[model samples]
Target: MSTRGGGPDRRGVRAKVEAQRAAERRAERRRRVLLAAGAVVVVGGIVAVIVVNFPSSSSSSGLGPEGMALQTGPQLASVSSAASGQTVDGISCDSSEQVAYHIHSHLAVYVNGQQHSIPYGVGVVEPVPSTVNGGTFVSASQCYYWLHTHAQDGIIHVESPSQKQYTLGQFFDIWKQPLSTGQVGPASGHVTAYVNGKAFTGDPRTITLQPHEDIQLDVGTPVVPPQSVDWSHAQL
Candidate 1:
């Protein structure tokens, strides 16, 4: 009888050891689950940081190919004569050295020295290309205008690189509503101009030019006459 009782006690101790082993295994599995959850959280935070710092790929910007949001407002700049070495005002300026833009909208054009504002962004009915002696020519619709130095032909030509059927009048019409004027200055002997705060990259500059130099300023986009729309869409 005693021997049999000892045997039963030994069996009971073995059963307890097995149960303890199973409990230890369950505890280990719970620890593994917690560790995995922590790792996932850490990795997710790292991905979020990378996405936030990425650059934007949008149109209508100097940086991107698409139209993207930008900062625009009234800026200050000057348009000088390319031929006579004189500072031409809006009234007596010549088409070769100066362009007096008339704005149909109620927008204000503050002159370099004049305290009161003037009317800009109006008058011309079509877009025409006028080369400058020093500054580069660009269409307003493709992008904003930023010029350096003065050219002989100080005119802003209205033309669309898109070549869509739109009138120069229509383009400037849209601009008069939202556009503001800025200034053109010099840097390292190089004269430049920025219209409507479009050129913000280099140091802040103004519009100044040597004799016979030209600076082109775009006040609006050129519209393509409907008769000129290329059926060349067949090229596609």
Candidate 2:
């Protein structure tokens, strides 16, 4: 009789132990869920940190083969001429003692139909002083790249490497200014680009820099006769 009476009690204790084990399992699952959520949050925070520390679109840029998203911004250094001397990216610059090449091109920039003067010594590391009413675009400097301006007349002197295609956007990039369809440095308006007096339907960055080729960019209304370079008067 006593043994039979104790059997029910034993069964009740076994059921209680089983219920405790089930509750423990549920609690463990909840802990795992919380841990997984925490890991995701931590990982997300780390990614955000990395992105902010990396370079922005306004700096550190390169043009693709098709001139896609060509960043017309400042460079990491002065093309690092000090480190590499007269050659970079397998391209050579003017000699340390004298100008090696003197190929010239014409460039015209207008904002609201008003012409903007290209500054002299724009790409030079040691810039020459500019005088009022007249500015030398390409001021003599130690490390002269092929792309430079000698005066505000908008003539681009490819005085470094020879027989290499340069782009108009690269000139702006070296000038440390923004160039886009909607903006050119501080001038902001509708931009229209022309290559050799013909309307450029492609990205402005694709304008191939060529000798005596007139590249005009108007930001605002189009001027009559098109603001092209005066080939007859261009100081080639």
Candidate 3:
């Protein structure tokens, strides 16, 4: 009879111990879940911060070939005479980049279906070493023409002291290159001109350098079609 009574007590104790252990296991699982959720939140926040802080250089809605990106090919020409602070076509070269009437335009050239790049420092004189906002050393020029370029991206920066009309002819003159319906730079043949993906019927030189305008010139046979570029992400 005593053995029977002791058996019930032992079984009851064993059941209680099992119940307590089950509760502890549940608590541990809950802790692990909470920790995992916290880690996910932290990682998500970091990704959001990175996305907001650093944007992509290329645009999602960009057109034409990806080769249109800046510095994709060899430079077309060196800096023209305007780089020496000489006045060309009434445009002056100042001691610094002017921002009073800042604007940007793009130009592209193709010879026999092959693309050529426009060089940086086209109208800037004597590039010097300087640090940018990110503490990166880059070539900064001593003088800047009203029409200039800071990269080999075919972007013509029109940073003038005053707002006024400028034309492709003036820029070419500043570049010390010749442009006409018959010729462009060193390449000579039947010249085809395009403005904003449309054939420009008038003198190619007379094409105005408007803000965000895309200009292209094709030389010789196998004239390439007008190409477009994504200016949406340009920092000009």
Model 1: per-residue Cα lDDT over 57-120, one tens digit each: 3311221111111112333222221212222121121233222321111112223322121212
Q: Answer with 1 or 2, whichever has the higher lDDT.
A: 2
CA shift of 92, model 3, Å: 1.9
Superposition TM-score, candidate 2 onto the true structure:
0.53
Instruction: Give the Cα lDDT of each candidate.
Output: 0.29, 0.60, 0.76
Question: What is the C-alpha lDDT profile of model 3 across 17-44, one tens digit per residue?
Answer: 9999999999999999999999999999
* Residue-level error in angstroms, candidate 1, position 92: 24
Candidate 3, clashing residue pairs? none
Residue 137 of model 2 has an lDDT of 32
Alpha-carbon RMSD to native, per candidate: 17.4, 16.9, 4.3
Ten contiguous residues minimizing lDDT sum, candidate 2: 63-72
lDDT of 2 by residue, 24-88 (tens): 99999999999999999999999889778874644423322111211122221232223223344
For all candidates, the clash counts are: 39, 9, 0
